[model samples]
Target: MRLNHKYFSNLNNIANSSPQGIMKVSILESITNGFHLCCRSFEPVASAHILKELDELKTKTKKTIIEDVEKVKRLESEDRNALNRAVGIWKAGRDAPHKDAKFATDASI
Candidate 1:
């Protein structure tokens, strides 16, 4: 457990050492208590050009999560058949915006 924390801290410090560094990394573990040992580790490394691909992936992931939550909300508030029809229409191109469509995005979503 001590070793895990040491490594995680080292990695985080190195990743954020640069004056203009923006990347973030984290590792969480609680096996010594009840969580888990280094169970969830998020380490992302990329070059200048690969950053664009990472951004695109992040956008897609956010969109998917948003749509999934919306679908759950709609299911809870509206009829299943109606939701299905709306999805079908959306899928069939009813001149609606794409689910993963990009819009002006800022930190304040």
Candidate 2:
């Protein structure tokens, strides 16, 4: 069965609503299409504009990540080093002192 324009348009709406959500959907679609082709011999073709939008979405996602990292770094430098250190230690398998500390800090500013 062919996916109609309405379906893709809905996907575009969803993609525009949230970048992370769009990335997840894109990854899932890619995997599903790959499996469909590999196991069922169904050839899936994406439209050029959809591919272009996906590319733009990826670029925007990377830019957002970079900006977030910069903000995190700024937080780390401005007397929030303790929170950063806590995050690092927690990431390395240690129990964090306060689980919501990072979120709290982020929300504060």
Candidate 3:
């Protein structure tokens, strides 16, 4: 697959000079390069799964951003109850840190 010179040139400009930084940047560039290759390579036999996943990601991202904006607006509009509920939920998650950790460890085991 051919790499895009323009993309690599942009990456090159932003990339740090350190070996690890360069390697990290090159890996990202390779993925960006690979995306074009994959589209071309898989065009003939592409499944609906890829489109479905992309759509799902788009939907979830939009929903998350919209909800965040709504939450901010609610807070700004002096909706103390809604703000308190949101804070309570956030704090509950933080208070249950060990629950998530144990669940992850249990799943791995």
Candidate 4:
């Protein structure tokens, strides 16, 4: 098989960048070595099993990413709502400067 040298070199750089990267790279190398050994030994079942695990890992990672995105969206919405409320309060205080000093103080606070 023709390998993508640039792609693999980039992956290697990423894998060597941090502690988590090191651990992930180590696991990946172990799995790759096992797959090669199984193939050489004519153990198709073992190779298939490794492929299945990799697929499951991909699925789990995707699920986690989706969940994280949802959480970020929710937090952003909450922050926008809060900012709108603050702006509304500030506007109200600015509109009625003499009627209520408390409103201006609360808004500033």
| Best candidate, TM-score | 4
lDDT of 2 at 53: 90
lDDT by residue for model 1 over 1-109, one digit each (tens)?
A: 3456777676667757865444333322343345443343322333554888889999999999999999998887778787888999888896776677666784545
30-54: candidate 3 lDDT, tens digit per residue? 5766653344444533456688888
Instruction: Give the Cα lDDT of each candidate.
Output: 0.63, 0.67, 0.70, 0.73
lDDT of 4: 0.73
lDDT of 4 by residue, 1-109 (tens): 3336686667678888867785556544645455442334445656788999999999999999999999999999999999999999999978875754466458565
Model 2 Cα shift for residue 27 (angstroms): 32
Scored against the true structure, residue 1 in model 2 reaches a CA lDDT of: 44
lDDT of 1 at 73: 89
- By TM-score, how accurate is candidate 4? 0.51
Best candidate according to lDDT: 4
- Measured on C-alpha atoms, candidate 1 has an lDDT of 0.63
Question: lDDT for model 3, on a 0 to 1 scale?
Answer: 0.70
Report how far off residue 14 is in candidate 4 (Å): 47
Higher-ranked by lDDT: 3 or 4: 4
User: Which ranges in model 3 have alpha carbons more than 4 Å from their true place?
Assistant: 1-47, 79-109
Model 2, residue pairs in steric clash: none
Candidate 2 lDDT score relative to the true structure: 0.67
Sorted by TM-score, highest first, which candidate order results? 4, 2, 3, 1
